[model samples]
Target chain A: MLEVKNLHVTVDGQPILKGLDLSVGAGEVHAIMGPNGSGKSTLAYVLAGREGYEVTEGSILYQGRDLLDLSPEERARDGIFLAFQYPVEIPGVGTNSFLKTAVNAVRKHRGERELDAMEFMKLMREKRDLLGVNEEMLRRSLNVGFSGGEKKRTEILQMALLDPKLAVLDETDSGLDIDALKIVAEGVNALRSPDRAMVLITHYQRLLNYIVPDKVHVLAAGCIAKSGGKELAHQLEKEGYGDLAGKTGAAA
Target chain B: MASETTTGLPYADRFAAIAATLPGQSVPWLRELREDSFARFAQLGLPTPRVEQWKYTNLHPLTKAGFEPAVVNGQGRGQIKALQPLSSLLPAEEPAHRLVFVNGLFRRDLSEIGALPEGVRLDGLGEALASEAESLAPMLGRAVRSGDNALLALNTALMADGCILRIGRGVSIDAPIHLVFVGAAEETALAFHPRNLIVAERDSRAVIFESHVASNGGVYWSNPVTEVTVEDGAEIQHYKFQDESLDAFHIALTEVEIGERGRYHSFVMTSGGRLSRQEIRAVLDGKGAECRLTGGYLARGKQHVDNTTEIVHAKPHTTSKEVYKGVLDEQGRAVFQGKIIVEKDAQKSDGHQLNRTLLLSDRAEIDTKPELEIYADDVKCSHGATAGELEESALFYLRARGIDETAARRMLIEAFLGDLGEDLASATVKAALQRRVSNWLAAI
Candidate 1:
């Protein structure tokens, strides 16, 4: 469903992603594992159309359309979702109200009937029950004074509500404990379908235990160093990235 | 103090022409008060930019207009009827006791004061002076002094008519009392001076909503002064909404005195007038008293709004809080000057003040000054002021969620001032203010 060819990205004139290429088909889950300073988060941000990230040379194709030409909101309406590592804390906007606005906006862009207050409440209740999110958390300001676990759950709740076709999880298990990691993985696994795809970006292989991926790709420097099956994660965990970095340099 | 009479001498002649026909001119005490105030105003003239209090505000609008006294009888009820369908300006669901004044003169035909409770009186100042002068002798001009400022002196000198509200001891009025002042000038530019006096006896409770609105596109000046006295253990909430014409000018002064254990809360919302200033001076005279001064102003398209306030803690164990916010767009300019003073013997006094401004355009300007003067070692006082554009991260977060740029900006601005709006006691008034905020946002 998505293809990236020789993606070159720069931030403030400093090159971060250099000639990176990747492709994923429909209904497939890809896990991009790398050490620190790898361009895993940058790829997610670039796909979601964040500002200040200059695309020096590359082309990103999403469902046969150029994704880089769209704005952030347009990309959101086009079914591209990025679950941020650090959810922003908005002081005055209630979480429920924000979710409603976003849901309606996406629905309107897709030429669908907008959900009213009653219908929206019913949908939110079903999602809350499935994700085990508290009702009081939705009543409070968005992510303001929320715990790390709560924030991750809120992001998962939003994902369930929006029901995007392509979801990019950026370090979704960074600050989560074991229990929270299990909950988040369960939430992600429940949304798996034949037409949906996910890109899980992580530094460690701990999350791969709960939500197993079909393909595992090791990202070193900026490009994809190696691609293998799920057994590759166990090998990477047993042996550090020191040997892989050298082999990847020779292969590139 | 440069007392040179170059640009302000014309107002002296204008005041002289209307002195003979003003209300309460026959009373010797009132006559002497007007004469003294006129002399003071002549000496001070209009406060120039050199005056410390008027440094950020320019009075050239008032001086250049050369306004004359508003004709009381020239505009009839038909004109007021034409200005009707005022559902947008009034409260939504609650039944309010309304006192309507046109051009600073009490319009009996347009006012509706539905049967008030016993021991409560709400009427015009002219009527109260003619019948109950003895009871009002000690209250009038007591909270506000003549020599405090130039505008107060001018208001005292040419004061015509305004509303007077009095509540007896131990009585509580449930419904809000609304005082509406509508300004409609004729071919000649008119200026009106309105003086309002409110006295709540010991242990009494009441709420007052004061609105200044203009009906036509005429250029006029509405200079109003209000004096409030909250007796021991009494409570009062005052809301002032100013929405005048774009070509009009407004200058208002409010003086309040809170007794022992009394509570006073005030909120001022401004979104009108070419040039306007609302100055408030409150003093906590008795121990354990509390006062809250909060306001928000939205200025756009060359409009200017200023809010200057001073709160004095003269007794021990008193507390005061102040928060003022402003949003300026286009060439609009705003000023906020807030000062808190803790006297030498006022031990254990606590005060906090904050002023925040949001500049929406490159040319918009805001001048904020928050001052704290503490003479008591046991007092706690803190003040802060900030001015900046909207936060970039917050804006991006909203936009990334599919909200457009304009809707995101409006939501952020509303959230910035949401706390102050939620502080109001009446849901109806809060809803009205929210609607006004939305309207102001839509206009810009």
Candidate 2:
């Protein structure tokens, strides 16, 4: 469902992702582990079509089409989602209204009927209970004064609502505690289907235990150093990315 | 202070030609007041950039245009029909005691006044001047003086017609009094000065809404002055929406005085006019007096909007708060100057002021100045000013949720302005202002 061939990217005239390659099929979950400043977040932003992430060379193909040709919003309408590392706190924007606008936008793009206020509220209540996001939290400003756990839980709720084809989770478990992490994992596990693909980018192997991945790849200096089964996550956790960083000229 | 540029004022001939026909012409005191105001205006002339208070605004547009005095002949109902959309701020179903003015002349045919509560005076200024001249003599130019602003002096000199609202002692008016001023200049460029006087007697309460709009897309100038007095323990709520034509110029001044334990609250929204300025001066006079001022402005194209305010804490335990936000795009420019003052004897006074602006284009500009002068050692006072563009991260967040670029920009802009109206106590006024914001966004 997604393919990256020798993708090279730069930000503000500085190269970040160099000759990175990856492939993921339908219903497959891949975990990309890397040390700090190894282009893990860079790859996620590139796939989401954020501005200023210049593609100096190579290309990205999603469902046999050039993904770089579409805008950030177009990519979102095409079922590509990116959970930001640091969720933006937008004041004066109600969480419920923002979610409804986003859901209706994507629905209209897909030729599906838009949900009315009552229908949207019903859907929101179900998801809100599942993710433990209370009513007051949704009524307040989007992400404004929200705790770290609440922010992560809201992101998962968005993912469940959008139901995108390819989801990119960037450091979703970084600020979450074990209890919050379990709720997020349960939400993601419930959304898993044969037609959806997910790429979980993490700095540790902790999240792999909750939602096991079909494959694990260690990224070093913007390139995949090794590719293996789920056992590789445990191996890397026991030892660290010290050997991979040394071999690829990336500092640990 | 007169320079070569201040010598020639076209209004000298117009004021001379119409002094005999102005309101309250028969009264000697009113006539003397007009003459003295005109003389002071002639001495001060049009404000030049050399003056510190007028440094950011330029009156060259007024000098270049040959704007004649607007005449009230009562001949343009069709033109007013075309302006129905922009003139009314209240909902259609809402029962409002409204008074309409065209070219600064009160239009009795277009106004609707139900049975006002006893002791409440609501009518045209011209009518009041003709009958109750003695009662309005003390308030006509009491709060605002000719030396404070040259344009205000000019307004008093050539004052034609406006609203006169007075609430008696201990009376509370339930319905809001809506004032609509529509500028419909035909062939010749016209200029009108409207003077509005509002008085809330001891322990009285009232809310007043003003809408200044243009009926035709033509060159005109609307210079208005509003004077308000909140007596001991009285309360007054004032709101204004200025959406003049893009080819027009608007300059307005509002002066208010609050007595012991009295409260004054005002909110203004500006979105049109080629060059405009809204100046407000609020004085907290007695102990426990309070004042609150809030506004939102939007400027696009080559529009220039200015909001200048001064709040004075003159008595012990007086309080004041102010917040103003603006948005500028294209080559638009905006200016915000706020000054807060606590007198030497006004101990325990509390005052705060804030001004913020958002620039949407590289060419858009903003000049913000905040000043605080506290003489009392025990007072609490603070002020802040900021000018910045929209956050790129916030924009991306909205777009990444499948909202288009235009929709994303609209969402962020709405959010930026929506933050200003959260504390407004009037739901109808809040919704009206929000609709104006949405309309401005859609037009841009």
TM-score of each: 0.94, 0.97
Native contact fraction, candidates in order: 0.63, 0.75
User: Candidate 1, DockQ to 2 decimals?
Assistant: 0.67
TM-score of 2: 0.97
Q: Best by TM-score, which number?
A: 2
Put down candidate 1 lDDT per residue, B1-444, tens digits, no spaces.
Answer: 122354363456655556766667668788788888988887777888899889999997676786767744333221466337553466634688888888887887878788888999899887666556677779888898547487888888778789999999988998899898998877777888889999989999999988888877788888999999999999999998899888889999999999999999999999889999999999998999999998999999999999999999999999999999989999999999998999998899999999998999999999988878888999889898999998877777677677777888998888887887777887777887898889988865
lDDT of 2 at A136: 94
lDDT of 2 at A27: 96
- TM-score of the second chain, each candidate in turn, equals 0.95, 0.95
Interface RMSD (C-alpha) of each candidate? 1.1, 0.7
Error of 2 at B332 (Å): 1.7
